[model samples]
Target: MPIERLADLANPATTPRIVFKVGSALLFGAGGVPDREWLASLVAEIAAAHARGQQVIIVSSGAIALGSARLGFAKGGRGSLADAQASAAVGQIALAGLWSDLLATHGIVAAQLLLTLEDLEDRRRYLNASATLGRLLQAGAVPVINENDSVATQEIRFGDNDRLAARVAQAASAQAVVLLSDVDGLYDRHPSEPGASLLEQVKGVTADVHAMASGTSGSGMGSGGMTSKLQAAEIATRAGITLAIANGTHASPLARALGEEIGTLFTPVRRDGARKAWLGGRLRMKGLLVVDDGCARALARGGSLLASGIVEVEGDFRRGDPVIVRDQAGGQLAQGLSEYDAAEIDRIRGARSNQQEELLGYAPRSAVIHRDQLVLL
Candidate 1:
């Protein structure tokens, strides 16, 4: 199908569960105050989506900008980590208040979710977050997610909400993710540069696609530029979610981005099952389990990783953590959520299924990493 057809918001088929990544630059006006008129228009677009039975999730930025204004910090005066933290602490209140009030006027309840990178990395926390967001959606509430900047140290920060938005879409299994930007779409060169051209459709985010983005970050009000949006596009599309980078300056930006060909559209590959998406999309592994040739062949044939097959357990990880499955030759073949903790797996290494009960006093599962939870690399 032509990628442009998916941009039509009027086509219900193009949208089911949609995630909108709102930029700080678009949320705040001069002096870092809330741009109420602009926000109202965005809310109207969201309300229209609701009317059509489409669920919306907003991964918004601007807490730091709003908080800095409230704390009397001069524009661009976010000097230290502490200063940014203070600003986020103050700005989150204003950001939530604005969203709550605007969404309320349209009869939509706003639910706030403050997350850290750890929330998505830990398997247990990942499930908790998914359940919470799912319930909020089921109850007809719009989830307004943001990184917990108030407590996030420089090392822990998502850096920009663009990537966070993609992770959120993946976690929620959203069908589409829209990144609202100052410009309409990706360009062959900086839009300000002579002879630049817009790209309306992208099948994948290749290195050439990334090269098209400007080196500079976005407006001072936001940290993410077209570069981060491309990173986000890569994450979303890989997880089978379509992504759009569109201009948010318009009166009904969401509606316009959806219904018109006013932005760059990224098409997703065929989606796998939930387990596959989670297993395949994880960027970090908590541990590694090396197995013999027999087990490697079993995994290649879509079989589980049995405890008896494991030769060595490397890394400190609790049960249910993501672990890489490697062969004795040191080649990675798959990854999955482990059914046993690292210590337990160490004790049960090279043990048969029946021997698990004898070694651990009880056997909860025969497979160290079940086939249902595994994804081949």
Candidate 2:
């Protein structure tokens, strides 16, 4: 089936899983404090979705803003990474408290999740995080997700929650990712440019489509610029998750984004199988297994990776580690749990299955990576 139109997309009745990315501008009102009126309405919207059996997750960005005020820093002022980290630590408590309290008024429970990039990269951590979020939804609680700014360095920091929200959508297998920002939607040119117009529905994020995005980070209250949001759109749409960019300043922005057709909608490809879905997301693999063209073809045909097909193994990883399968040309083919250790695969690369016993101490029970464990990309 083709993707739905804006009218259908806005109707909360259609989407099952919705990830709402709330920027600092929406969370902090003009006075730089938590906006209870806006937040209350937003919770009401989420409660309505919950009553209808729809799962809602919040990817919020307000810890730094809230923390800065608590720590006596100027609003929207620049600070060192250490300062920012301290602010996040202070603000996270207040932010979580506000969410919990406001959500309680609507008879909904709020669960705070602080995540670092490493959590989403490591296979074990990724699975654990996803399971925890999933359980919260099952129990009718909303997971309020935020980056672990307190400990993050430049290398590990997501910089903006825009891309992080996209990763969350993929991990949760959410149907749609709604980025509620200061702007209403993407425009043909910079909104400041005279005669610029909004692009209602974006079919593909081509170079031209990306060109439509402005470089300016929306408001001083937030860190993410339009560029990050577009980058996020690319990630989510490719993962079979629809994305919408809309204004979040008003009440119940989630419902408005889904029901008004006012935001820019990025269509998604058809969802893949469970295995493929797991592999396609922004997961961190422990190593790489470069294979020959024949192996890539076999994988495409649903075949397991044989030792004979491996050209090389890069990185030192243990058995049961998540590894990426790439072709000799350095293109990714699949990702799976490796049955053999790095040293073992290094010794068995390009060797026939029958020769494993003579080459190594013991013969393996199955292929290097079984079909069940592999996900072709």
Cα displacement (angstroms), candidate 2, residue 113, comes to 2.8
- Checking candidate 2 for backbone clashes, the offending pairs are 10-258, 10-259
What is the overall TM-score of model 2 with all chains considered together?
0.76
Name the candidate that leads on lDDT. 1
Quote the lDDT for 72 in model 2. 77
Residue 151 error for model 2, in Å? 4.0
lDDT of 1 by residue, 1-377 (tens): 22344455444565668889898889878888788998999998888888788888999999999888888886643777888889999888888888999999989999999998888766678889999999999999999999989998867667889888988998887888888999998999999899988888898777788888974566777888888888888777767888888999888886677666778888875566766776666656889999999999999998989988899999999888889989987877888999989999998999887777888988548688989888876
lDDT of each: 0.84, 0.82
Residue 250 in candidate 2, Cα distance off native in Å? 5.2
For all predicted structures, in order, the TM-scores are 0.77, 0.76
For residue 321, model 2's alpha carbon misses the true position, in angstroms, by 2.3
Cα-lDDT of candidate 2: 0.82
- The Cα error of candidate 1 at residue 253, in Å, is 1.6
How much does candidate 1 score in TM-score? Answer: 0.77
